[model samples]
Target: MLEIENLHVTVDGKEILKGLSLKLNVGEVHAIMGPNGSGKSTLSYALAGRDGYEVTQGTMRFDGEDLRAMAPEARAAMGVFLAFQYPVEIPGVVTMNFLRTALNAQARARGEKEIDAAQFLKAARAAAKTLNISEEMLRRALNVGFSGGEKKRLEALQMAILKPRLAILDETDSGLDIDALKLVADGVNALRSPERAMLVITHYQRLLDYIVPDHVHILADGRIVKSGGAGLARELEAKGYDAVIRSAA
Candidate 1:
């Protein structure tokens, strides 16, 4: 469970999240739909404790702990995962190696026993298969020279393997065809459970068709202006962002 109150964040000295407040409870899937510059990604980064995205005001409480007090790795170990809109390419680090290291690191941070090589191999392969990631792909460099769909699937695979408590998916459906999108969405949907929560930040409603959210919120000017059930997502899809903002105004 994550609670944010009047969160104000600034990136490179320019404010992005302005008086934004959102609370994600266990077992709830919240979708944030907004046009560009509405601070959706900022909220994700602020929650992930990314460097340079400073919280100027407000408090973020994760699992009852002050989120700002913990390092980024600490947040991940606390079951927070952020799937970037544009996954960075890390050359030289094989996909399997990167995942193994990340998983082991998080486990060690949380006082859990490190997974042995055989266990990691079995788990990674299973998770990757759910995302349609082949063994060949996992042997390649991490997100290097991969297509957009490949990158997104890889992100989903990471989430599946991590089994995060709160997953923040920042435009995971971006740059994908209908088929590819379905694959990625299915991977995301598989991770949904009563003990987990997800914040799906998407610009379009098509993604919602596959990964249905329990609540949909319209974020504008760095704050959530409206909240509704699944019907709201279809309304925005039919009317567009400008219409929604005008109506909210």
Candidate 2:
């Protein structure tokens, strides 16, 4: 569903991603594991079209269209969702209102009729219940006064509501407890289907235990150093990234 070819990204005139390339197919889950400063987050920001992360070279195609040519909102309308590592709090923006607006925005872009208030509420409530989130939480401002786990849950809630074709999770497991991690994984697993793809970026293998990936890729110094099956994650945990980096060198 997504193809990134020779991607090189730069921020503040400093290149971070050095010719990174990877391909993801619908219904597949790929996990990217790397140490700090290995350009994992940079790849996610680049793919999501975040500002200031300049694409020095290479191309990205999503569902047969050039992603680089599209705006961030345009990409979202075309079914790309990014669950951030840290969700920001938006004061005065009610959670339900923000979610409804976002949902309708995509629906409108797709030429589909917008969901009515009643229908949207029903779906949102159902999704929130699945994620163990209370309706009261949904009524509050987005992420305002929420704990780390709460913020992550809210992100999952958004993903569940939107159901984007390709979900790029940038360290969703970071700062999450075991229960919260399970909740996040369950939310992701619930969205898995033959028409959706997921790229999970994480530093540790713990998260992989919950949302097992079909493929595990070890990223180092801005490039994928190794690609293997799920077992690779366990091996990396056991042997550490130094071994992988040494092998790549």
Candidate 3:
């Protein structure tokens, strides 16, 4: 569903991703493991079309759409979802209201009618319950005063409700505890479908145990140095990234 080739991204004035290429098809989940500053998050930003991460060279196609030409909102409207490592707090906007507006905007972008209040509540309730997002939590301002786990679950709730074709999770597992990590993973796994794909960027393999990626990739020095099946993650964990990088080299 997504294709990237020779993607070079520059944040500020320094290049982060150099000649990175990868493809994710529908019905697959890919895990990208790399050390800090190895361009893992940069790859996610480039995919989400975040501003200031200029794509100096490369072509990204999302189901045949020229991904680079679309704005971040357009990318989101076109079924791209990004879960940030640190979710921002919007003190003035209730979570429900924010979700409502976002879902409505996406529906309109896809040429579908806006969902009604009753239908939205029904969907949100089920999704939130599975993610352990309480109705009371929904009434609070977006991510405002939520615990780290709560914020991550909120992101999962958004993902489930929107059902994006391609979900880019940028360190969604960072601050989560064991139980919270399981909850977030369950929420993500519940939304997986034949038509949906996920790119999970993480530093630890512990997240992979819960998410169970279909493929594991070693990203070093801003590019994918090695790709393999699920066993690759376990191997990396046992040997460490330094060994893995050298092996790839």
158-215 in candidate 2: lDDT tens per residue? 9999999999999999999999999989988888899999999999999999999999
Residue pairs with colliding backbones in model 2 are none
Q: Root-mean-square deviation of each candidate, in angstroms?
A: 0.8, 0.7, 0.7
State the TM-score for model 2. 0.98
Per the 3 Å backbone cut-off, how many clashing residue pairs does candidate 2 have? 0
For model 2, the stretches where C-alpha displacement exceeds 4 angstroms are none
Provide the TM-score for each candidate, comma-separated: 0.98, 0.98, 0.99
Backbone collisions counted per model? 0, 0, 0
lDDT (0 to 1) per candidate: 0.94, 0.94, 0.94
Model 3 alpha-carbon drift over 4 Å, by segment: none
Residue pairs with colliding backbones in model 3 are none
Model 3 has a clash total of 0
